[model samples]
Target: MAFSAAESKLVSIFCQSVLYGVYVVLFTATTYTLLWGNKARRSVRRHNMLFVSFLIFVIATMHMATNFSRIVLAFIIHADAPGGPAAFFNELSNFTQMFGSTLYVFQTLLGDALVLYRSYLVWERKLWIVAFPCLLLLGSTATGIGILYAFDKVVPLADVFVVQLGHWITAFFSMTFTTNVICTSLVAYRIWTLNHRRKHGDSMRRHALRPALLLIVESGACYSATLLALLILYNVDSWFQYVVLDSVSPIVGIVFSVIMLRIASGVSTEEGETALLGESGVVNSGGGGVQLSVLDADPDQKTVAV
Candidate 1:
């Protein structure tokens, strides 16, 4: 069946509504991050997390706001009305619509950078292990910048350039997904390897690796799955691709904030610590750092540095 313009617009609106539902979670998560960061004591990691989370909060909000503006501009103005959807969007000169794309790209870059940084830390600060992801990040950033340049320079772009835009988007999403996968896998594997040395509260399960592993997988999977969907659909030439594109920024924001919130709350991991079970409220075997009473270490066993 042929796709009608009204049908397309309806799908786009539906996607935006779904994103708004997700945004509720985004706002909540961000508020929790802010509150938690405010209460956290001064430390290198604490200060860094606060700064990064705050920066992401600002960028994610901008991205969501831009999306809302474009959605209103696209849907509220009737196509038959003066300066309808076509005309408004046709003017690539109209900065608002395209601005969302840039904001989304910026947010994606920041998220990728954060994950890579965590990976670097988890791997005993071994820069070589994360070097590949870092390189991909740089390339992804350059590609994203190219897209921005394309939007600005090719206002009222030719029909032939649509495929060019698609290619750029595909590259961007693919790089991000790869980066996420590598970072998440490295972190999870490192934790899994350390699971054998587990020590925790039998009553509360406060120091178990299973829960920490689950949280990391679940949270990272939620974000990765969305991007993977978008990446797969990018080449399919479907209306749903447009819909997924519409919801991209909000979904990323929600996932990013949710992870931060969990960290801040000390639910999955502690602020300013490595993403390990010990970081998830375990009794630190190393007496030099935090000492939680919830779980006790075996006197006969050696303290393994995770």
Candidate 2:
């Protein structure tokens, strides 16, 4: 299982190269979204905004840590002579891996939160809609972590197998796909119901549904691609898996940035305003912000001061 000096150096270089590429793409996309999108300037739904931002930071940190580890590994592998520096690099790599695992948990949690938040928006007060998903995600994440800890410092084979399975179900495939599907279906159903109930041609209904549709489609595509990549990696060896999985974060980050930007840009039309805010004052519309009260309410009817 030992690599020759030249082979080790080559592998290290390749890993560093792939990691660097991921870092660059993710940083670029995140930076673009932050700069061009008015997410920071405008008010938004507290939960959605906070969760999305948190996810972005976690993904960024994960990539940075992975890249740093690869750089250290490269240095260790390519060192002309082995000494204190090699030992330091090895230790640093292990530290990065440990921290990376923790970040991965945060990443999964954030994704689940995003889905739960969407479900909350869709089925307001049907608390179970959000609660069930949150509970499932929490259980999945906890189980993954427990499995990894069960085989702590023991060559990582068991940990990797358990984690990879968890990722396939929770992180890469099921959570994203299934959640998006339910949310999208609910949003579409709401749209259809609104359209059917309207007396006249409701332009507003269409406008309001646009953003939700866009989000659903974009998220669906992104998750689908990520899942495909995961499937491909599952059939590959360790080296290929490392390269492919390492490439995933940057792509996910980019997709997130794009979706957030679209949200920040405001996808709803004037006709869609009513669709955005349900009869109950909750905004069922896409993206952040909730309507607590109708802006067009009669002033004379509600003169009571708060």
Tell me, by lDDT, which candidate is best.
1
Runs in model 2 deviating more than 4 A are 1-42, 46-51, 78-93, 123-125, 150-153, 156-220, 235-239, 268-306
Stretches of candidate 1 exceeding 4 Å from the true structure: 1-39, 81-93, 155-161, 196-219, 268-288, 291-306
Write the residue-wise lDDT of candidate 2 on 35-151 in tens digits: 555543453443454466555656755655665564565466545544433333333225555565556545545654564554465454477655656666666566546534543
Candidate 1 lDDT score relative to the true structure: 0.61
lDDT of 1 by residue, 76-186 (tens): 864566656645554554688568777778888887887787677657788999999999999899899877776676637332137547677678889999998888777
Please give the lDDT score at residue 298 for candidate 2. 22
Stretch of 10 with least lDDT, candidate 2: 297-306
- Alpha carbon lDDT of each predicted model: 0.61, 0.46
Clashing residue pairs found in predicted model 1: none
Candidate 1 lDDT trough over 10 residues, lowest sum: 271-280
